[model samples]
Target: MSMDELKRRLGQVSDLNAAAGLLSWDQETQMPPEGARVRGLQMATLEGLTHELFTAPRTAELLDAAGTPAGETDAAVVRVARRDFEKATRLPTEFVEEAARARNEAHHAWLDARERSHFATFAPHLGKMIDLARRRADLLGYEDHPYNALLDEYEPGMRSGQVRAVFADLRDRTLPLLRRVTAAGNAADYGVLTRPFSPEAQKAFAWRVAGEAFGLGPAFSRQDESAHPFQTNFSREDVRITTRVEAYWPACLFGTWHETGHAMYERGVAPRWERTPVSAGASLGVHESQSRLFENLLARSRPFWERYLPALAKVAPEVTAGLDADTIYRAVNRVQPSLIRVEADEVTYNFHVMLRFELELALLEGTLRVAELPEAWNAKMHDYLGLTPPDDARGVLQDIHWSAGLIGYFPTYTLGNLLSVQLLEAARRDPEIAAGIERAEYAPLLAWLAEQVHSHGRSLTPAELTERATGRALSADPYVAYLHAKYEDIYGLKAEG
Candidate 1:
């Protein structure tokens, strides 16, 4: 088959996958509870069709014929398409449909269980999801660990052992810092942030931050509400993000910024790669870097609030009564151990990720059972953060990842946190990017990212992209150093050796 024909075929499959994504997005954002059953079937049918189309014998023939790199873009397309084809062919279409249905059912069960703070309601569904995950790992095949097979699904080249090593380094560097910060007590007046902020005012402020502050172009992107804050885009021209707004101030504000980072990355991908296998993020880890960068490094910075807090006060004057940029900055960065991962302080966030990664490894390895997940979760929370969740909702059911069949995905979050600082440090070395950040004019910084990171899409692996952009391979040093500097100054603690 010719390259043109191959592109057309692959584009069709991509379209079907995007359609499935739209359905899933709607189910989460707009669909009523009664629609869950039909929505599950709809999603399953779309996924099964996409799987069959991509894994057909014809795709293999075309992938083989589309040999050697014609150019950089074609090379990426062929390379990514070949990898995807091999992976997809390993699983049967029935398994694809079954997994989709299972995920949908499990998501609903998790929602109900979490609402009631009942683990028993969700346990059976979790067990089913775990079984499916194991089956997927077996199908994908792995050398050293079954979790490695699942990890490669999200991170491409990453393995379980590498994630373990990185987490070990992070734990070593962070625990003492956490202890110091905790002993010092609340460094900032976080009570100012807990004041009742109306949802309407919060929505307006979040939109302003996402649209004006973050440069999520209004023409192509939009914001909505969901049970869990998320970003989804069918194409570069139509990106959508959602954030859950509550009485809390930080929920909507930072959540919108986080999703904006994800959407902006989607929007920044080169238009030429649209509708192709390589058009999306290079990997989930790289994608998470954008979100964590915007949410923590940028949104929580003193400079960010200096520019935006005045505008925010205009929107929600009640909450900003005694609050200033400095107070808000310190409040947002306050080092308090929290039950919810999404609301965790920057200093303690990775401990949450680390806990989840370990539990996921155990679950995949059959060392941990779904029935015992609540007890295990509470134990880890106490061990890592020194607090126990009062209920299962705050504990095992806090996140939607396990319910959605997103196994082996937690590590990418910490990986993203690490990469976020590395990328920011590298960008600071460039005078133009530094000036843009200093002036709160983010275009230069965004452009640098577009050119250096986003445009390449899957043209390079995550490690290769890190090296290309940062002048070194991935490491925990940049992230650790960043945390130590930021937290020590905030808490007035002595510098680390």
Candidate 2:
């Protein structure tokens, strides 16, 4: 099999994947309640077909025959295909189909269970998904634990032990910071965000900021409001993103910017490799780095608010009627425990992931029963955040990830935050990035990321990509340093105990 044949096969697989993704997106966003059954069938068929196509024995043989490491072809293409093939073939076809079907059904079921505020209603489905996920991990094989297998799926070289080390450092440094922020009290008022800002105005304002501050031009991207904010790209030229607006909050603004960060990375992928494995994000962690960088580093920066506040004031006076830029900046960055993971403060967001990671690990290891999840979740939230949710809606059922069988996905969010600061540190040395942020010009930073992170796609490993971009391995130093700097500035207290 030639390189061209390998490319052709991968392209076909990409198309099937895009179709499945679109169907899933539609079911979540726009499909009618009655359409779920049909949507499930459609998703199942697409999943099965995609699995068959990608995992066909011949596809692996062709990928292996494509080229040599030293000289036969572009190493990126062969390397990506071979790597993906190895992982894809590890799980059986039956498990893949069941997992996909279960995910689609679980997503729909979760919507209802969330509305009713009941985790018990969703427990059985979640249990099955967990069982399947454990089987998947066993199939994938791991050195330390089954969770490591799932972790490798998202972060390639990352292992469960590494995440534990990083999460521990984060928890130790962060809890005290949280306590201080709470003890000192919120330095800025968030009343500006609580005013009745219409959803329509918020959407328009979010788009402007996404385009002007994030360089998410519509030619390469489209944004729509959804139950959540997410970025999905099929090709560099045709990226799709969704953001939700809160009728009484400013979180949507930051959320849009976060999703835009993801869109920007997708749009920045090297066009020549579009429709192939090498065209996608290097890894979930690296991908999160782009989103977190924009959401927390650039979008939440004081300078960013300096330029964006005035424009926002014009559209929604409530946001600026009583608040100054410092107040708005402080408000958005306030460190406090929150019920929703997506709305968590930057300083404490990892705590949410840490909580979930602990729970999911227990579930997978068979130490935690599905039926006991709500009690366990409430206890953990109280133990970790010192605040307990009043209902499952705000607790175990808050996120759609678990219902969709995503056990190992939580750590990527924290990893992304860590990488975001690390990359920003690298970008800060360029001078232009700071000047542009001061002027509310994101082109320089976006262009820099494109050259350094997005363009390489999966051509590089997550570690290689981080090193090439930030000149270092993944570490907690940047994230911890960033928290210390930002919180101390906002709360006017040393971030030390």
Per-prediction RMSD in angstroms?
Answer: 1.0, 1.6
The local distance difference test score of model 2 is: 0.84
lDDT of 1 by residue, 1-497 (tens): 47888899989998998999999889988898999999999999999999999999999888889996678888889999999998999999999999999999999999999999999999999999999999999999998988988999999899988888898988988999999999998877878777878887887788887777678877998888888889999999999999887666797889999999999889988988988998899899999999999999888888888888889888778888988788888988888899999998888999999999989888888899888888999999999999999999889999999999999999999999999999999999989989778766678888888888999888789989999999999988999999999999998899978
User: Which stretches in model 1 have alpha-carbon errors above 4 Å?
Assistant: none
Segments of candidate 2 deviating more than 4 angstroms: 69-73, 495-497
lDDT of 2 by residue, 1-497 (tens): 47778788889999999888788767656788999887887888888899899999879878778756564236778788888888888877777888888887888778889999988789889998899889898888888789999988888899888899999989998888788878988687766657888888888888888887777887777777666567777677878888787755656887888888888888888887778888888888998999888888887888888888899889988668977788889887877788889988887799899999999899999999999999999998899889899999989898888887888999998899898888888887988887886776878888898999988888889999888888899888988988888888889996465
Error of 2 at 256 (Å): 1.0
Scored against the true structure, residue 311 in model 2 reaches a CA lDDT of: 93
75: Cα error in model 2, Å: 1.3
Q: Considering every candidate listed, which one attains the maximal lDDT? A: 1
How does residue 180 of candidate 2 score in lDDT? Answer: 81
> What value does the lDDT take at residue 247 in candidate 2?
59
Could you estimate the TM-score for every candidate? 0.99, 0.97
- Per-residue lDDT, model 1, residue 127, is 95
lDDT of 2 at 135: 89
